[model samples]
Target: MGADREGGARHRPVRAVAYATCGVVLLAGCASMPDTGDLRDVESTPRQDTQVRVFAMPPREDAGPGEIVQGFLEALTSDDPNYDTARKYLSAEAARKWDPERSTTVLANGPGTAEDNQTGGREDSGNLTYTLVGSRVATVDAQQAYSPAEGPYSRKVHLSRDPKSRQWRIDALPAGVVMGKSDFQRNYMSVNKYYFASNSPAVATGQSATVADPVFVRKRVDPMTQMVRSLLDGPTNWLGPVVRSSFPTGSALQKGVSSLTPDDQNKLIVPLNDRASRAGSGKCAEMATQLLFTMQNLTPAVDSVELQGPSGKRLCELNDDQAVKRPEYLYFLDGKHQMVRIAGATSTSAVPVPGALGTGDRELRSVAVSRDEHTAAGVSIDGKSLYVTELASGASLGDPVVQSHGATTDDRLTTPSWDSHGDLWVADRDRANPRLLLLEQGAGRPVEVQTPELSGRMRIKDVRVAADGVRIALVVEKDHKQSLLVGRIERDEKAGEQPVVTVRGQRSTTPGWEEVTAMSWAGDSRLVVVGREQGGVLQMRYVQVDGSAPDGLAPAALPGVKTIAASEDDRVPLVAYSDDGIVRLPSGGQWQTVVKEGSAPVYPG
Candidate 1:
């Protein structure tokens, strides 16, 4: 998948294009072709209903060409369902062909220069032009795909007169719709669709590792139903191989039931097609988990979920408390290099891991814990080899999961990161053969991860995978500068074949920093990076995964900070190795020394 690969968008017969007009010929050409995706045709009733409210759409039938454009521009911001009222400004024929579902160009302001909204056209025919100006902030496609599109924008609405009605309306325009940011914010909501981790074996243990695929949906328009549909549609291609859906391959909503609605008691009733009836009790419970976790953000929240078959026969039912919550297990390498964990957010004491590995003689340089915390993969102090040890018994599962290929002593293995599904991610920066590897939770052999975007000469300093399993954060050395980058993880799992993992879309998380020493995911969309400007002291700051600085003050500086770790839970505390030794930031508290000998600290991803 490319940069636009994971975007979820919707469009049937509609096409949209963001145009930069220059020559008149190119401007006309912009109206000729469809952009975004392939166009398909679908039919629906045309309504300018007053009862169904959405964006504001004021009357514009009596307005002039300029006034019509201005009126429509103002009406576009109203929360009138489906922009039906906005359609009233269009000629009936144009209204029939125009599809707001094609795309939406969100602007910083609803519409600009509408005051000077000029019109140009011939007097003999029904053709006319209206230019509505504004700054484009982002574009959200019909499939709910969003992308930043910062720049000035021009909506050149080509209007034509309906031969019978003789009223001007937007006829040949761009494929997608356009709206202001304020209106978009009020109407859309961010939601996470839950899916089981394909690499996890927890299903046998009563709960599977759940991954959340975040997306934005229309808030008031049966959001729960839309969320479920999107979940059933499956994760985006980048995440497809990493996640599994409980809903069967061919399963769908029952015919004529386009959405799930809550009963009087606020319990959601989801009617699935007959395919869902084939699922066993275990499968039904998994499906219920997916639904309940997905709809947890809705207003009042869903207390329970009841799956119904085609004829309304009960399939499975689960209460809110039954949903599987995201798991967390924190561990760190102490002064003695023993694998130990923090007891609680407020507790300073560390506990030894259950297995011999926790108390064994082998000194660990870095450690990564599986979601189930049953096993851990650690890089030995020399960084020559990686070892997998059992947490309960201290028995060596694999003496050398992988060994270094680089020439020098500094060519070492980076800290390991474990995905929720139990796969371990680590980079062997041996200059001779620097490689990224993924260790299957229970399997011995390691799978090499390839990212063509990474420079061949670059050395991997650290690797951190997000709990969601869809993203990874990397500390790398290139051209002698240590940089921080985040990438989307994609996998190709073929039947009876070993799965191949690839990281393609690598993005900088600290674009302006000259060097990055340590980094970890602080939340789903944020990261804590220890960075410094050229010749400057290292400062630990909370930066968005997108590379923007979080609002307010940066987290208290970590003077002499060497390695850092933060919990996946945003509200959880942070820990780091500073000059003062193993120091940790308690929840809303100042940094305190947790262990004098601690070095590498990490929480379950």
Candidate 2:
């Protein structure tokens, strides 16, 4: 009913450690033990013809190995095409070689394929050549496998001695071939085929068979015997199918099924109902949900899913299961509309209301969003405090604030804004000494800017810190008249002696720009201001640093918009707040809808 609990690797066998030295002691030890599962002996024949003949025996029958090898070399390299002429000097057994099956000549090269100057072709050679570095047992090497298209080639040969004749020869050459999984498996199984062919009759007759190559047997099949021994010696209940299923299979799917852990594969083929019957409610629900979700996505059992409230009322229906798994995150709505968290199969247990923002316990000081929705600012609640916790994860960052007497009390603290260099700036809103605090990169207290000329009779409505954090702009009521004041901060070692300058417009300013609700840097040189007048209509205006004011960019229809967020590239303004839903405005000649009002937009950083 449930998954099996045991598993084992496929056909792993015990192997003997091979030593490089082949002395009497090694041979004696190898002779005493017969390695299991090797069947390569069927292909080895001691009686096979093993002589190499030449057109003439060299003058040095006992010549040094080098001189004897040179004679064989001359025979093969004398002609443009070496095969026919080279075959003439070979012994009857070697000369009669012909592979009608195409297997032996799979990589052989033909005429005009050898690039030797004796061959009449400019193209690259495509033949593998074994150089006769003298006869006897001096050395064996290969010339490059020539290719017509490529000019260069290199090769190495496998040299071996004939066991029966006790003579040396270049018996094998390296094959530059890569086998696919099927081919490898097929060839791998052939070793077993020969083993069984040689041993089955001996086992049936109750007689011992001569051992095959000890090196090959121990290298390959002995490990499977060990694996079988381990499985048989362990607990029998769980190991049966695990051992049996660990073999190569008919197809990839079958192989994949075979390859899984015994438990997982059993879980796959076993009935889910049976497994669930024994599971506790919690475990059952978890498993069932995963299975149901997987099946719902992969199969066509259900048409759609309707999320209902506890009262049996439908909340939201999703045609796509993919959408249900990741419902849009709604951040700009209040309790009356958007549901922040949902619980259970039904959606009745929704939690978290909008506007009632969580500021990570008492750690966050202040928070503010720009009217244009392009910028947001926050600082610590107390003037003495420096860093505040991020509302989402409680991470901390240093924020600058204008120290006011009542900053520690219930007095409203201004939200600190960030500039391009990650500096924070906020105004001392409650004090008679209302000054601008410019937070910089030093280790001590913040540097303050006080301009009595800019502070008198001024009730700051909105304050904006520019991208440099060195520039401060504000909409203040000075002398009972609303005015726009732009100033630069003079940094110094002291706490509050820096001077500020008011930038004058071309007309020396008419009435000074008024009703500025929020401000942010629109570009390197421009500032966007979101504000409203007596009519309660919202207006977004862009102005240069040197200018007084400019015309509105967005229409006056958005009266309830409060906060704005900008795209990473600053190409769009997402105006969002918690009242009716969420709203996004892309910066274009005309506004177009990207995210609907009711669905929350997951802000990607």
lDDT of the structure predicted as candidate 1: 0.66
lDDT over C-alpha atoms for residue 295 of model 1: 59
* Cα RMSD, each candidate: 10.1, 30.3
Each model's lDDT comes to 0.66, 0.30
TM-scores for candidates 1 onward, in order: 0.74, 0.32
lDDT of 1 by residue, 1-605 (tens): 01111112110001111112222110010112111122211111123222233444345443445445545655554444477766777766777887877677777766553221243234235666555567777666555545556678875667666677666566666665666766566555455567877754563355666765556666555667887788777875545666789888888788888657667766888888888778999999999888876655433335678998977799999875532343355688877887888766667778878775587788878888776667877778887878877778647545687888666546878877887667788888877678898887735688999888987867788888877676788888888898888777777878887787888767676765789988887755567888887788778887655443433356776689988877655555788888888887865568988768677887765
Q: Which candidate is the best by TM-score?
A: 1
RMSD of 1: 10.1
Q: Per-residue lDDT for 1-605 in model 2, tens only?
A: 00000111111111122212232110010111111211111111111111211222322222221222223333322111223433332334544552211111111121011112232222122222232111111011111111112122233322233445434333333322211222112111111100111101122223221110000011122222222222212212211111121111221111112211112222212122222234444433333232222222122232333322233433333232332121122233222333232222122233442222332222334343322222333344353343422334333344433445654443334555554433456666665455556554222455565555553566664456543333456667555445455554333333464323232211111133446655544432345556655444556655443332321243224445454433212333444442434454543433333333333222211
